[model samples]
Structure formats: C-alpha cells, structure tokens
Target: MGRKWHGQFEGEVVTDHAEYPLRGRLPGCRIKHRMKRNWLKMYDKAGWILRVETVINDPEEFRVRRRVRRRGRRRTEWVPLRKSVAYLFRYRDVSLQSNAQYLNALAQVEDPTAGLRGLDTITTRKRSTKALNPVARPDCQLFTALMSGEYAVHGFANRDLRSKLAATVVRLNDDPRRQSAQVSRLLHRLHVYGLVAKIPRSRRWRVTAFGQRIMSTSVKLRQWQFPANWPSCMTPSKLVRKNRRPNEGRSYAPFSGGPSTSPLRLVTPAIACATNSKLL
Candidate 1:
C-alpha cells in the first residue's frame, strides 16, 4: 500500500482494499476538492478580488462617493423639516455684518461716508429700513480721506468720489451706475448730518471735529470687532512746508558798494570852479 498523508480521519478504520483503496487516498478527498472548487467559483462570481484591487488603487475616490451617498440620503430624510423666517433673517444679519466690516475698512482708507451713499442708492420707499439708515456716504468718504490723508481736492470737483464708491459697490453687486447715484445721495445726506462741510465757492470739503471724533471711534470699534489679520494701511502724518528757505538763504546781504570816505577832502568849491573853467 502507498503511504497515506498524515492527518486525522473521522469514523471507522478500513482494512479491505476493495472498500477504501489504501493507495487511492481518502474517499472524502473528492468532497474536499468540491468544497475548494465551490469556494473559488463563489469568489469568481462575486469579483471580490477586483473589488479589493479597485479600493486599494484609489481609496479617497471611494470615500468621496460614500460621503456623497450619505449626504444624499440625509438630504432626502431631512429636507421636509423646515426653519422659521426669523432664522433665515439671522443669516442676513450675518451677511450685513460682513458688509459692515468691509465698509468700515474702506472708511478707514477710502471713504467712511460711503455708508450714506449706499443708503441713498436704495429707493425712497426703502429709506426707513434698518440697513438703509446705518451710515451716510459723505461721512464715510470724508472719514476715509481724513484717516488716510489721501483726499485730492481735484477729485471732489470731478466727481471722482462717486466713481470710487461705484467701484466699491461693483465689487459687491451689479449695476454700478445705480450705486453712483446712491453715493451722490449719501454725500447730500452728509451735508444734512453736518459731518461733511462743502465749500460753496469750490467743489471741496472739510471734515468737522465731530466727524473726526466719529471716525476715530468707528476705526477703534472696527479694529476691536474684526481684528483683521492684515497690517494697517495708515501712515504717519508728515510736516510739509512748501518753498522753505534755509537759514543761510534767509541771512541779509551785506551793504552794497564799497565804504564811503568823507566828502573828498576840500579843494571843494575852489577846485570845482578851476576844473570847470579849464574844461570851458
């Protein structure tokens, strides 16, 4: 008989070659072979090997897909649940806060009076609204110019203030022309507020002490509230005097023409008469 492989066998020991064939291995060998064959068939049918390979190649892709599926399921499950209009308005308040921060920064550098201008842009019907009443245009612009000390008198005459404010509005919304109108209105309002004083003879303006105080307070408040990560754009004031003369240039010139001697010593009348007769 051939040597049998060493392993535990269940049930009766066989002695007859005709019943068990000692040299032909075990009877249940076929069963074990069938089990392995069935396992491989199931594995092939499931394509588990390919699935594992795809997962290994790009794990994040699968994770993203899974997240999307989860979100989709949650959306379907929770969309029916609704919130109050007041809650929605809260978001609007947050948006307004962000806008306020931007406007405040612009006021420090561009124009504090821009708020008045923004208010003027809204329709008259909307004038009573909280957002519309926050600030005036001229005030914002004047404050910005004062803080930055960058205002040009020429700009006021040419309506460049409106242009600058229009550009700012364009960054936030469409229809810049409408924004310009609003800026003009705001400037007019500033005249009402007495924060901005317009020179009648020329298209120029100067900020009042009250306006300066307001701007200072606004800047301090904004700095405390927003705490921007960027550095401030403010510059120190410089003392400038045009056509300044140096000490040496200011010194008086010495008395012109050489020193004088006392009336050319005598020979006075006599010398004068003799010289005159000789010439004749």
Candidate 2:
C-alpha cells in the first residue's frame, strides 16, 4: 500500500457488482470497499448522508495564496538636516553678518521714542483726562457744544460742530484748528461711550439723556465762572435811557444859562440873486 496523506481521496467505489464492468481491471476497484462501507455506516448514524457527483472534465479552476514581507529599518541622527541648511544660509557670508550688525546698530541709534512719545504720552494724557471727567475735558468740546444750545439745531454734522467751535475759540484766542482736533477726539470718545447718538440720514449727532446728566454734573463739578476780562459789545451811546421825569425840583437837562431871545434874520437880496442866476 502507498503512504496515505491526510485529506487524500481515492477513486469512486461501486456497491453493486452488476454495475461494474467485467474487465481485467474495474473503474472503482482501486477504492477500499471496507473503508467506504464503514464511512457510509458512520454517515447514517450521524444522519448526514448526502448525494454528491464529481465532474471529471470540469474547467475554470483557480488557486489563491497570501504572503507578508518585512521592510528595512531606518537610521537615527542627533543633528537635523533642516537646522544645518538654515545655519548655512543664514551665515553664508561675512558681509551679511556685518550688514546685519550695522542695521541693528542703526536701529539702536534711531530715536526710539520719536513715534512713541506722541502716541503713548499724548494718548495716555487724553485717556486720563477723559477718565477723570469726560465733559470737563476740552477734547469733549463737541459733546459740550451739543449739550449747550450752541449746536442744538445744527446737530453733530460731519465736523461741522467742531469747525464752528474752532472758529468761535479762534475768534476768542488763536490757533483754532488744533483746538478743533482736540474737540473732535473728545466727541469720538463720547460717541464710543454711547453718550452720543448719530442722527439717521445725516452726519449730525446728539447727546443722549445720560449725556445730559453727565454734562449737568460736569458743569457743577467744574463750577464754570465768567472770565473777568470778558468783553461786551454794548456802548455808552447805545445804553438805554430811562424814561423818567425829573423829580419835583430836579432838572432834566444839563445845567446851562437861561434861554436867550434873538431876532431872526434873512438874506433876501442874496436869495433873489441866486434864484435869478439859476433861472438864467
């Protein structure tokens, strides 16, 4: 008997001797009849007997298999390639380093506070003034004008109120434009704080009720008093004369001598000569 391997199948076996050909070698003679009988008995006992057919000349057979491959490992380096490239490009030449140092020195020599003084100091002062009391600050003159009856009808138009205030202050002093800018800045602050509202369809603005209250408080806090040197347009001649009759013996007119009697004279000859000359 040849060595039997696991899962190997023999040729088909026939149970009926009449179905087999009476040749020298039968087609199913190679299979072990005893093993086939035992397998059929086991199948009957397990109730798994199945009718099966084998195709001897079938086509379309294929085989499939799976395989895994290992990959090569990589090396580790302490220094990075990108850092080396950056260093090379940055320090490529001596001139570049010299120029960089020169630029740094120039930056140091330049007026560092040139731009910052106006921006930082002036801004801080303005903010401090506004915080102390918004309406009291000259910067808030636009809001002040709005609070006052000066621009009540005009409203807060595009810098119109500021221009008017500038003109007024200039008429009073000098360099009104600078004062006007300060007023505009204050008005912007008031608008940001929601104390003022812009009128729709126009550049004019107005103070809210809260603004009015703040203005009233500011007026009280500042205790504004009329300047001693304030000028007035009234003249002595235009001064109103009181319509009062002299008291009993008091005289109404300036004291002068008593009224004098004088004869009325007329130049008739000269008048007649002038009339004759005009006619001629």
Candidate 3:
C-alpha cells in the first residue's frame, strides 16, 4: 500500500465465478497480489489465514543501523538488510507490522453486506435505466480515477475530480465547459448506479458501502483477472547507442531503393525513436 509499490504490482484477483478445476471448483477463493520479477505477494488461505509478504528487492528501503564493536568500542553503522542474516529479527518485525497494518485497514472498512443488497445492485438495470453503463469506456475510467487512494477517505467534488481525469481520460485541450459536462454525466450515473451518494445539499460525493467492494473488485478484475489466462506478450525495445554531431549529414534509403546522403533531420524524440523501430 506504500507509494513504492503503489502501481507496480502485476497479479490477479480471482472472482467467485472464475472456474479453476476442469471438473469441480474449490469453495473459497485464492487471491494473490504479486509484483512482477520481485515476486512480492499477499495471499489468503483456509478462509482465515492471511499473510502479507514482499521481497527486499531494494534493501535501501528497509535498511537500518545496528551496533557493532570496533576496536573495543561500540558504534552504530548502517546495516544493509539484504547483505546479512544478522538483521533477521528486524526483518521479521517489519513484516509483522506490515501485516498488522494491512489487517487494520481492512477492519476499518464496513462489510459490503451490512444491511444492504449484494453486488447485483450494480449489475441490475433498475437504477441505471439509461445506457450509461459505468463498467465501460469513459465511465469505467472515471470510476477508476475516483478510486484513487486520496479520495478513499474524503470523497470528492466534480471540480476536484476533474483535475485527476483531465489529460488522462479527458483531452487537455478540451474546453472547461465540455470537461465539466462530461464529468457531471459520469458522476450522475455513479449516483444512479448506487455506487456513490451525494452529501445533503452539497456537491461532494462519497462511495457507498456496496460501491467500495464492487469498484475495488472490478478494478482488480480488470487489471489482472480478465487477462490471467491470456498468452504473455513481449515488449520490443530498440537500443541505439550512437553518438553523432548534430550538424552531420545522414542517409535515407529504405524506401527509395538507394542510399542518399540526406541532410541532418531535426526530429522529435518520438520520431527519432520511430525511425529506429523503437518507442521512446
């Protein structure tokens, strides 16, 4: 939950409907939040056991000082956690603290089923009679933006939310009026969908209890669950380690069927990368 791994995790949350075995499915769910390469993960077992763990991929983040004897005198020096097993107690303490903090955060959240209907409240068309489905497109993106950590505790106003969506979901060049109108429509749908509720006589809105669970679950599903079974895709990188004078002449020939000493071309970093079959 810290900023270090805030958006670095790459894993999936298995929904109840997801099938595992070829013949029969298991009762409880196996949820995993993992970071690629580093393999940091938090998972549950037997419906009651919960464990929070992470690799010390970067020892500096958890490094501490320890006392050591030098020349018959005791002094403290920075002890890199990854470099020695002597600091295993400190490591265990930090891990337990993380687990406790995670549990405390979960305990503070009200149960989704506390005196309310199930997630069907969102799937149903009763509230959202219009075709404005938040689970899709611009609407979905807006929902994700609202679910940002800062908004979790204190909700948001349309004006405050606009800043988050602009230049990401909404075009930065768009006029202010257009941006406001778009956000207004999206927030309206959220209210109708029972995912958010407006404060009395105020423009502020906060996520409903049911919405907390649904949106959180949906985000996890979209990020990891839906693509869990898909074949892994490789990223193509082009490495150009050339250094040339800016005024030097260059050649262009791929399409003309002949090499020609062309003038040095001043191009954007993007175009330069594109010319070399790379993406900057």
Q: Please report the candidate that would top lDDT against the real structure.
A: 3
Taking all chains together, each candidate's TM-score versus the true structure is 0.27, 0.27, 0.37
lDDT (Cα, tens digit) per residue for candidate 3, span 4-97: 3446545442322222332353343333443332323454444566556655555445656788788999999875556468777766666666
Task: List per-prediction Cα lDDT, in the order shown.
Answer: 0.38, 0.42, 0.60
Best-fitting candidate, measured by TM-score?
3
- What's model 1's overall lDDT? 0.38
Task: Arrange candidates by lDDT, descending.
Answer: 3, 2, 1
Clash pairs (backbone) in predicted model 3? none
Q: Write the per-residue lDDT of candidate 2 for residues 201-249, one digit (tens) a residue.
A: 8767887766676565455444443232333654432333233333321
Alpha carbon lDDT at 57, candidate 2: 21
